[model samples]
Target: MKVKRYVVDDLPQAVQMIRSELGSDAVILNTKEIRTGGFLGMFRKKRVEVIAAIDEASRKPAPRPAAPTKPIVRKSEPSEESAIPAVQLPNAAVRERYARSTGTSDAPAVRTSAVPSAASAVAVAVPAESPSKEAPERGAFAVPDDPRPARPVQAGAGLAENPDTASLLTELRSMKEMMVKLSKQQTFRSMPDSVMNWSRRLAEQGVEAPIIERFAEEVNDRLGTEGADDESAALSVAREVLLEWLLPSAGSGINSSTRIVHFVGPTGVGKTTTIAKIAADQSLTHHRTVGLITSDTYRIAAVDQLRTYADILNLPLEVVFSPSEAQRAFKKFEDRDLVLMDTAGRNYRNELLVSEVNSMLSPGEHAETILVLSMTQKYGDMKSVASQFAKYGVTRLLLTKVDETDSYGSILNLALEYSFAISYITCGQTVPDDIRPFDPNEWVSRLLGEPAYA
Candidate 1:
C-alpha cells in the first residue's frame, strides 16, 4: 500500500494526484491525518493523507526504473509480513508484483468474493453494489489496513502484516514534494533567495518528478532571460511578479457606478485610519472632492479620527449609527467625486453584522468595496478574512504595512487564486508619503531573480 500527504486545500488535488500516479485501477485504501512536523519533531497540521495501492500486485517491474536520485534515504521495506527488510521499494506495485510473480506467498492477494464487487480494483468494501459496471468505487473502505485488492501475507522473517508502514514512507516523500512545490510557488511570487535554495535542498531529497520539473521551469525562466539586469530592475520586477500573482480582474461584484469606498476588516487592522489616508490622498493630491463617512459609532473616538482629517481639509464628515443612516450619509456625498466610508471592525465570521455594514456601503453607482488587508497579519487569518469579506462584495484590495512582513506568501496565494487589483500599498500611517502606487514592472523583476530593493 502507498500513502501520500498533499497540502492543497481540497479534494480535486487528491483524486487527480492518484490518477496521475497509481493508474486507473489504483484502489484507495484509507486517507486521514498527518503532522506537518517541525524542528521539535512537530505538531499535527491535519493534512489529508491518501492511502492508495494498485489492485494488481506488481504486474511487471515498474515501467520506469527507479533513479538513485541523491542523498541516501533509508526506509524499512519488508518483502512480506514477518519477512526480512528489503531495499527501498520503488513503487508499491513493483515490489508487491515481484513477490506475486516470483511465486512467493509474501504478497497479499485479492479475492473477488471478499471485496464488494462495486469496488472492483478499489476494495473499499462498499456495502451497496454499484448500479453500473463502469463506475465502481473502491473508496468506500472502512479498514485502515484494508487491502488494495485482497489477500493475506503475514508469515515471513519479520515484516508484520501492518498495511500502514509502507504508506507512511511514501507519504513522507509526497510531503517533501508538496513542500518543494510550495517553495517554488513562493519563490516565483516573493523571489526570496532563501526559498530558492531550500527548493534546491529539497530536490536533493525525494520530492516528486513532475513537481521538480515545474520548479525547474520557474528557476530556468529566472536565469535564462537575456540581458536582464538584476539590481536596478528589482523594484519593477518585484511589481510584475506580484502582479502575476494578482492578475487584476475586470471588476467583480463591485458596482463602479456607486462611489462609496468602504474599508472593513478585522479589528485592529487600521481600517479607520487607512480610510483617512485614502480620503486625504484623494482630496488633497488628486484634487477630488472627497467626502468622509464613518459608521464606526460603536467604538468610542472612532469618529474623532475621521473628523480630525475632515477638520484639516475642511471636508464634510458623515457620522451614521445604522446601516440606514450610513446609506443616507452616502446620499449626502453623492455629488462628491469620491466618498470614503469607514465601518467599525468586527469579527469577520459575524455574517449578520458584516452584511449590514456591506449593505450600507453598497456603492450607488461609482464606489467599489475594497477590503483593506494588513501585510503584518497572519496568512491563514488573512485568507479567512478574505473569504469572509468576499461575501460582502469585495473585489478590489488595498494592502497595508508593506514594510512590515518579510514573508508575503499569503499575498501570492490571494493574487493567484483571487482576481483582485491592488489599488495601492501603504507602509506607514502617513497619508501621502507612505502610500506607493501599485506597479507591475517592479513585481515581475523580483519574481525573476532580481535582488531586493533598498
Candidate 2:
C-alpha cells in the first residue's frame, strides 16, 4: 500500500493532490493541521494535512474456510485423592492375576491414573467445559494416555495396562510445563476505543497515521517523566511557537519611532475594532498620543464602528474613502507618535481588493500594514486570505476570535512554512483586555494542542 501525506488549506485541493499522487484505490488514513511559520501561521496560511494508504488485500481473491475441531477421552484414575502418580506399561495385562500370591492388604495403596491415550485426553479436556468461567463441558481437555488394542485383557480391567499410554502421558505433562513458562514473557493488548476519533481528527487536518503512531509510542515511553527539566523544556518550546505570532508587543518591521500602523483583513474580521483597541492601549497604557483614521467605504457601518470607539476615547477620527483621502489623512496626523489606520477589509482572493489595499500605504508613507485574520476561518480559507493579502504590503498579522476555536494545530504549520509575524490575538468581544500582544511561548503552548497555560 502506498501511503502519503499533504498539507493544504482546502479539502478539495487536498483530495486532488492525493489523487494526483496516488491512484483511486487509495484509502485515506488520517488528516491534521498544525500551525506553523509566523503571524499565527499567516505565512503558511491555514494548513490541512491529509494522509492516505492503498488497500492491497482487496486485489486478491478470497480463500476457502476451514473445518471445526471436536474432543475425545482416554482413561481414569485409580484414586482421585492420591498425590503420587502411577506408571503403567503399554499392552500390559488388564490386571495381575494373583494365585493367592503377593498382594498388599492392611490398607490398600491409592493408585492415581490418567487416560490411556493423548488424543482422548485432548478431546475429554476440551469438550467437558462449556467454554465459560464457572461451568465446563464433559471431558474437555481431559484425555491422558492410550492403551494397546491388540493386548489380551481381563474381564473387569480398564485400559490402564497399556505401557505406551503411560509414556504418552509423561510427555504431555512436560509440554504443558514448557507452555506455562513461555506465556509469562509475552505482552497482552486490548483494542483502543478512541482510535476512530483520533484518526478522524488527524485525517481532517491532513496528518499521516505514521507520524501519529510514532508520537503515540513516544508518549508511552515518556508517560511519567514530569521532572522540573522536562517541564522547563516543554515550556521553552511552547514559548518559541507562540513567539511566531507577530503581535505588536513582539516587534516587527517598524521601529517604535514610527507613527503610523494600519489594520487590514477580510470583512467582519474585527480589523477596525482591533485597531481602536490598540490605539486605546497606546493612549492609556503606554501614554503615547495616538490618532485614528477609517478608510472603510465598502460597508455602511464600518466607519460607524470606528467612529464610536473614537468618540469614547476622545480620539480624532478621519474618514478616508479613497487612496487620495488616505494620503491626506496621513499628512494630517504626520506628527502624532502613533497613528492607527482602519482600512476597509480586503478579500485576499479579490485581485482588485488586494491592489487597493497595497496602493494606500505603498508610496511616500511610514505606515506599516497589519493583516487582521480570523482564527475560526478554515485552514484553506485562511491560506487564501494570506496569499491574497501578501501583495497588500501587510507587515505583520493580527489574529482575532482566538477563544472561539478548539483546535489550533493549523498555526504550527503556518509559522513553520511562512515567516509572517503575529502582532496580537483577541479572545473576547471586549476592547483592550480581549486584545493582548502576542507571546511566542504562550502562543506555542496554545498551538501545541493545549490551553494557553504552562
Candidate 3:
C-alpha cells in the first residue's frame, strides 16, 4: 500500500488530487483542518489535509498486449489481378467485441472475401460470439422516419466529459464522503476494538449509544494516561465511570418527619402495584403506622387492586377524586406516620393532566413527589415522560420492571437527564419481595457486566 497526504484549498481539490494519483481504489485514512501561509498564526488560510492510501497490487490496471501482424501474401500467378481479394474491414462493433472477449486490443481483422466462408471463419476465430448474432445497423431495420426525439446533450458538464469516467469519479467521491463522515462519527461513536467490545456489551444490555460512547471514551482516556494495556484494566475504568454516573443510593427510608409520598407517572407504569409494595413494606416489615390514599379513578380495576392490598395489610384506604378530596384524605391520615398516595395514570404528553396531578399532590412541605417509570420503556420515551412530570417537582424516581430487561443504562440516563435521584427499583409483581432499595455499588457492578456485588 502506498500512502500520501494532500493539503489543498478545499475537499474537492484534495479529492481530485487523490483520484488522479491513487485512482478510484484509494482508501482515505484521515482528514484534518490545517492552516498555512500565516504570519504568527494571524493571517493563515484554512485548508483540508487528506491522508489517502492505495494498494499498488490491486489498483494498478493490467498492461495491454502487442498488436498482431498482418500475414504476407504472395502472387499465385500472372493471371491473379490482385494479391489480396477486394474485401471489407470489420466494423467498430466487431473490433470492440473482439477486444473485450480476448482482454486485449490491436487484434488484426481478416478480409471478408479472403476466406471462402467468412461467417464460418468468424465462428472458428471467436467461439464466444456464436450464441448471440451481431446487431443490425440502426437504420437498417427501421420504418420510414424515426419517431423518437433526439436527447439534448448537456452543456458545460464539469467532470462529466466521459460517462464512464464521470461514473467512476462520482462513485469514488461518494465513498470518500462516507468514509469521512464515518471517521468523524468515530470520534464520538467508536472506540478501539478492545474497549469497543464492552460498548457492544452495553448496547446489548439496552444501554443507549450516546451513554455507551461516553463510557468507552472515558475508559480509553484513562487507559491511555495510565498506560494500562490490558482489556481487564480498561473494563475496570469503564465500571468506575458508570458507577460515578449512576449516583445510586438507598431510598430515604420512611421516617417520622416524612408524612406523605405521592407516586405519579405515565399509564401502566405499575403506580398502584408499587404503592402496594411500599405500603406492605412499611406496614408489615418496618412495623410503622401506614395508610393508603388513591386518586387512580381512570382504570377499570385500579381502585379494586389497591383495595385488595389495603385489606391484606389491614390499613385505612382513602379514595379521593379532586385536590380538595386529596387534602381531606391527607387530613384523615394526619395521625399516621407514613401515607402513600397513588395518582391516576394519564399520558404525561397532556400538560393539563400532569398539572392537575401536580396540584393534587402539592399539599404541604411534608409531601414528597416520586415519578415512577418502567424499565421496559425506551430511554427516549422515558425522557419525554420525565420532562412532562418534572412540573410535579419530582423529588425522586421509582423505576419498575427491573427484572424485565438486561440493561440498566436507562437508570443512569434518566438520573443525568432529569437530575432526579433514584429511590427504589421494583423487579417483579410479588409485593414487598420484588422491591429493593437502590444500592450504588451493586447497581454499578451489575451494569458493568459483573454479577451484583450485593
Best by TM-score: 3
Which wins on lDDT, candidate 1 or candidate 3?
Answer: 3
Error of 3 at 232 (Å): 1.3
On residues 1-454, what C-alpha lDDT tens digit does candidate 2 reach at each position? 6677777786788788777766666777887876656676457456788888876775455863432232233334434422222233221221231112235222222233344333342111122222333322221223233333345547635435677776787788899988865553231122122322333443444434443343333332332344223544444433342343323235343357667887777877888778877877888988888888888888888888889999898899899867888889878987788888877775667878788777776353555777788878876777777877765545477788888876665554344445567767788888877887666656545534445452
**lDDT, candidate 1, 1-454, per-residue tens:** 4554445445667778878877767766776666665667666455666767775565355664333232231222422232222222223453365455556655443322232222232222222332232322222112222234455645641223445766676788899999988986775655445334534433443333444345544544564444133433433433433444445632332233446677877777788767777676677776788788888877788889779878888899988887688778877776887788788888776678667677776554565677888878876677787887787557688778877755444454566556566777777877656876666555433334346542
Q: Rate the local accuracy (lDDT) of all candidates.
A: 0.59, 0.60, 0.74
Q: Against the hidden reference, what TM-scores do the models get?
A: 0.50, 0.48, 0.58
Regions more than 4 Å wrong, model 2: 1-255, 362-365, 449-454
Candidates arranged by lDDT, highest first: 3, 2, 1
Which pairs clash in the backbone of model 3?
none
The residue-level lDDT of candidate 3 at 354 comes to: 82
Tell me how candidate 1 scores on lDDT.
0.59
lDDT of 3: 0.74
Candidate 2: Cα lDDT at 58: 59
Residue 136's lDDT in candidate 2: 21
- How far is each candidate from the true structure, as Cα RMSD in Å? 19.9, 22.1, 24.6
| Alpha-carbon shift of residue 396 in model 1 (angstroms) | 0.5
